[model samples]
Target: MPESPGLDELRVLAHPVRLRILSLLTGAAMSAAEAARELGETQANVSYHLRRLHEAGLLHVVEEVRIRGGLAKRYRHDPESGSRFMSTDPREGQLLLATMAEELKRRSEFRVQGKGGLTADAEMWVDRETWAKALAHAHELSELLHRAAKPPRTRGTIPVSTTVAMFEMRRP
Candidate 1:
């Protein structure tokens, strides 16, 4: 496992393009060209983001495939880098929060646009122990889904976007 990234690294990871690139590489390996095509972005643009992620130690070159006598870098997301959700630096934290909000909105919008997608919200009160158990269960669920989505293995898959949150309802 990789240690958590530093504040600067988190800031770099918070860039929208970098986030999307990382997401694309998750559970799979891809070259910059492929990522660009998948994202409808220019090759140069995606390459820049890929380089930044590599420098930040968020990605690794898993293989190099020769295509037409030229080497193509195959990159995979580095799960060892730990969570990019928070940073010790205030500015980085702000950026992470903003990026997360934007991502939540984007995923929600995309899922709702299609048929038979889930978007749910609920408020619950529980003692600290029960809250901890609930949070633990959520983490377990995330791991299960992640393993199910692992590439180069799982077959016949449809992209699924899930957003789960549990919080105490603050009285306004």
Candidate 2:
């Protein structure tokens, strides 16, 4: 079987808090303190996770500035092409799967409390020749969407977080 890329980094990112942190900062940058406040967590707790993400190269310090007379550090997510996870062990795979489940739960819970349930529908077409073309098109479409969804030029802006989990398997 072909190995998934960035599996290890994905594992690190699978933590609910870490995933939340990334979602919170998507398309923009924020200070650790700001992230903590948005997540209803302590500054120290947010800092710890931010450090881990930075170490994994998933995030980086974008800027450091003084906000309201207090020195603060700002961060941005690292944009990388292809999968960043890098593990093959079954145990690690299980952990990655669990992390994804927890993240989904947290997001769903938040949505329910704020408004109601969210819904989405997807369709796929499968064929040896057409599948390759379709997959390539999807990749291009994703890049375009990412580029078009730029954050507004304002501070204290919270973005809507969306997670896309893709799994594909084939039998011969």
Candidate 3:
């Protein structure tokens, strides 16, 4: 297991490209060239982000193999127990919030283009005990999903941002 990453490390990963690279590696090891092709980016650009991610300790070079008489680096995501969602750096937090705002704007643009827009589905809950248990167990469910992948491989990393927020309604 790797050591938990700190706020600085998280900030290094907060970049859109770096986060996508990590997501791609989470399924299996990949070479920078392959990652670049998958992301529709140039190899040089992919290599840059790959180096940053490795420097942050979020990714590690698992192996170097000979390909076409040249060495190719294979990288994998190495998430540790200390990998919390919180960031100590204010700029990091601000960047994340800004990213969210940008995404909302993008989604709105899609709606204007006739794309199926966003929708909110809500339900009322009265059983605090049950809801709390469900919230706690949801983490376990996510872990299970992460660990349970068939073939456990991917062609490329897709940039995906997820926010799972659970909050109770205010008392009347």
Candidate 4:
């Protein structure tokens, strides 16, 4: 299994732009310029975040292509190698959660109605076995979605948003 990301790595992932970049790369390998164009961000800004994510071991350079006499490296993310953030640091968790909240809100703005969707929220107690089963099932579904992901604007594909954050809480 891959090592869990540390505080600094978590901080690198705590940016909304970086999160979007990660999601984009999961679907296809892309150079920084391509990702920037797809995400509607400046190339310089996306390049910087790509460097940070690559340094933190969250992204891998999968290919290099000659572009205007320079080699542009394409990066990709492997969902199977992704490690769950298991840090006990409250502030770090809060920072990541805040970033996720921002991303969720941004995605909500583009939500299409009248189509099939799911919205679920829960804060309840469950048996240990039940919790374990639920977590495993969620992981399976997440992997399915990632595997099925197509590049942005692919023909005959519908864009969808799936955000999942599951964790066990301590008793008060």
Candidate 5:
């Protein structure tokens, strides 16, 4: 298992399309064609991004099946693979956050209210103990969502979005 993504992997993940693809694969394995259809992207474009992610060790080939006399690889993302993003480079971090922001905007377009959800934004000083607890709680929530994720439009499953960014900021 990979502990963390390297610089090259971070670069690969800085693209909005790739980030969306990762999110899609987290719920289930999918072939490039399937992913392209779901995302409304060209299959060739999706395939290129998929290859980049696979080369960066962020995606795994879960299976291969015959389709139209050719083999199609199904790729999936393992949330437990310990591939969380952590970089000392400010530029890299900015790139990732920008990519995530783009994805958030895209997801917001499809937002449906009245079903109950969480929306939080904070950037204030906090006690050490409170910060520690918040981090733990955030991790727990993320794990819970990832574990409960199901394939797109799965029966009895509702589509949801979760985006969290928590870190201690340096005094400025």
Candidate 6:
């Protein structure tokens, strides 16, 4: 399996722009200009963040196209590159989680607005064995979805955003 993001990568990605850019790149390869259009920012501003992401090794060039006599570089996020991050320093870890949570909330809110995605969570009590069994099942479902989820190989492909988490609630 691919290794998770380290401290340096986490530090670099702490910027909100980088995280947003990474999300756009995840579903498809795009040029800086294309990403700017998606984010409604200047191409130069998007390019700056894209450079930072590439430097952090989270993105890579997949193709280049000649446009208006200039070369446009398209970059794609490494699907296997660091999906998680943790730090021995508590503050740093909290910061990482905070940033990640903000991005996730932003995405979820957009999906909610679109009116076709799922947004639900449940709280439950269970025995150790029951919890373990539920977790195993969740993992299995996630693996199945990951294998099937791709950027539409056919014309009828649908774009979807999904997030799943299950853990013991420690707070009310």
Candidate with the greatest TM-score versus the true structure:
4
**Per-residue alpha-carbon lDDT of candidate 5 for residues 1-172, written as tens digits (9 for 90 to 100):** 3255566668887898998888899999999999999999999999999999888768999999999999999999887652466776777787788888888999999889887887889889989999999999989999998888888999999888888878778799
**For candidate 6, lDDT tens digit of each residue in 1-172?**
4455566667876777787777668767889998998888899999988888888778899999999999999998864554544344555666666777777877665563645656676887778899999888877876666555444343676556655556565556
Better of 4 and 5 by lDDT: 4
Q: How close is candidate 1 to the true structure, as a TM-score?
A: 0.76
Runs off by more than 4 Å, candidate 1 = 1-6, 88-90, 112-117, 121-125, 150-155, 164-172
TM-score of candidate 6 on Cα atoms, chains taken together: 0.67
Q: Relative to the unseen true structure, what is the C-alpha lDDT of residue 63 in candidate 6, on a scale of 0 to 100?
A: 96
- TM-scores of the models, in the given order? 0.76, 0.68, 0.63, 0.94, 0.92, 0.67
lDDT of 1 by residue, 1-172 (tens): 4444567667776777787777778768889898898878999999889898888778899999998899989888864453544334556666776886677777665564647865566675678898889888987877777555555335777667655645444566
Please report how far candidate 3 places residue 92 from its true position, in Å. 2.6
Q: Whose TM-score is higher: candidate 4's or candidate 5's?
A: 4
Model 2, 81-146: lDDT tens per residue?
224464565566667678777777666654635554445546554666776776677667666655
Worst 10 residues of 1 by lDDT: 79-88
Summarize candidate 4's per-residue lDDT along 1-172 as a digit string, tens digits. 5455678768987999998998999999999999999999999999999999888778999999999999999999877644765577888888898999999999999999989899999999999999999999999999899999888989998878888888889899
C-alpha-based local distance difference test score of model 3 = 0.64
Q: Best by lDDT, which number?
A: 4
C-alpha lDDT values of all predictions: 0.73, 0.68, 0.64, 0.89, 0.86, 0.72
In candidate 1, which residue pairs get closer than 3 Å at backbone N, Cα or C atoms, i.e. clash? Answer: 2-80
Assess candidate 5 and give its TM-score to the true structure: 0.92
| Residue 103 error, candidate 3, Å | 6.5
Q: Cα RMSD (Å) per model?
A: 3.9, 4.9, 5.9, 1.6, 2.1, 4.3
| Ranking of all candidate structures by their TM-score, best first | 4, 5, 1, 2, 6, 3
Tens digits of per-residue lDDT for model 3, 1-172: 4444455666665566776676667667788888888767899999999998787667889899999999999898754521554554566666655655554554354353433433555667669898889778767755664564221233453322333435565567
CA displacement after TM-score superposition, residue 90 of candidate 1 (Å): 4.8
